[model samples]
Target: MTTVVHEFDWPDRVVIGTVGRPGERTFYLQARAGKRTASIAMEKEQSAVLAEMIDRMLDELVTADDKLSIPAEAPAELLDDAPLDQPVEEEFRTGSMRLGWDPRTAQMVIEAFPVEEEIPGSDDEALDVAAETESEPSEMLVVRIPVGTARAFAERARRVVASGRPTCSDCGMPMDEGHECAPEADA
Candidate 1:
């Protein structure tokens, strides 16, 4: 099967959002360019990591290109609070995600590859590198978000992650409704 990469360059909006309540929420990364929009379901960890990498990449881009118009400060809160668009069909459940900055195009590329399952009894030694490179990914979702949009995404994603269950101040473990850390034994 040929690998089809969905690219969204110069999107009108790129945002991270969730569905359901705090504890039982499902995270989604959505991008809108013209009339087409792509939404992909992802783990909270993926969202956090993507946000972090984007922030780092944007920093590098700013240093490389002095004329870039991206602002240094991210919004204190999400600029858009709208939920995932209706008929939210997930493109794919992301397994490995990557971010790259294209100097020629001056666009940040975010790519999501489908999770590949290992067949039982498959020998790793028998798999050749060329075969691997030639094989097409079942699906890939690529979105080129601008630096400014990326910053907003990073900030909002951090907020969403921090808004999860409270953590214990001392042990840093997640605290439930009635969580009571065992008292320290006489040391």
Candidate 2:
């Protein structure tokens, strides 16, 4: 799995030591000659077998010990995209504040987060007693929003509520009538 190579040069010869594999086989190679030595993994066997093969190969070849250096000419990367060009305005969530995109003007509209409260008394059973009905606040909110993208979000909410039951603006969770979508009764 792991291969190690060692190269040493003497005044007269060089000695190299290495161990690892030869493709599908395992072996270590050691080469020693006049003034040069290099070691590397070359086969599937003991270093002795590798040395015999390496000795035969190195004995006939021209040996050089100098290492040449090459440099890359490509320019370094620069952060050319980012610039002081825009301000931070768009946001995902803002507590009770809400906004939606308007296709007409490509802007945002402020929205009213509808809030509903239940009757405290167990007066639900008194539905038959029409006169006993309690008065409730108007669920519709008509807050004036500045002209721009922010105002568009609210206009969309108003349209959606006027259309029918309201749904979650973020995830499209349906709020059916008499439940999540219901407005406060003005009874």
Candidate 3:
């Protein structure tokens, strides 16, 4: 029973949640409610309980980079009001869902739960979407950094992201990287 409760957008004062497995389908979050950057979605057991609540909320609230300021009173589940690129009608969707992403790891399915409501050719006219809401628990933005300067800047960004080096792979291009706006690749 993987825990799931995502949805971020308004935070400031230092929010830096983490968890970007980038596989299977969705589970991406490089949160920074304070600095404004955001992304959220989960399923793999709610992305392992939001990666242990973003390592205990960045080990007691961020402080290293001092740039997690994403607050403007917009946190109720802002993902543009969710519906994640819309178009999904697989009979509304039930459980045991499967369909991941790989934009370097994953973070695709922005909204999907016990949702249901398919209206295709008719197969009992599926209908379940009573109310699942990303599962629940999304109120991010808790920066308090200083854990050794955010672990020395996350060990120098995990050694420059493990140094595999292979340029040009912005699978979904969430902007901020050369300003090409990846809008989930036009969703």
Task: Choose the strongest candidate by lDDT.
Answer: 1
Residues 86-179, model 2: lDDT tens digits: 2322111111323333335332232322223444566656643533443422322212222221222222222222343345665465554443
What are the runs in model 3 whose C-alpha is more than 4 Å off?
A: 1-130, 133-153, 166-187
lDDT of 2: 0.28
Q: Which candidate, 1 or 2, has the higher lDDT?
A: 1
Candidate 3 lDDT tens digits, 139-184: 3322233333233323333332333223445553322335543435
Stronger candidate by TM-score (2 vs 3): 3
C-alpha lDDT values of all predictions: 0.78, 0.28, 0.32
Ten residues in a row with the worst lDDT in model 1? 125-134
Deviation in angstroms for 26 in model 1?
1.8
Per-model TM-score on C-alpha atoms: 0.82, 0.19, 0.20
| TM-score: model 3 vs. ground truth | 0.20
Candidate 1 lDDT score relative to the true structure: 0.78
User: In lDDT terms, how accurate is model 3?
Assistant: 0.32
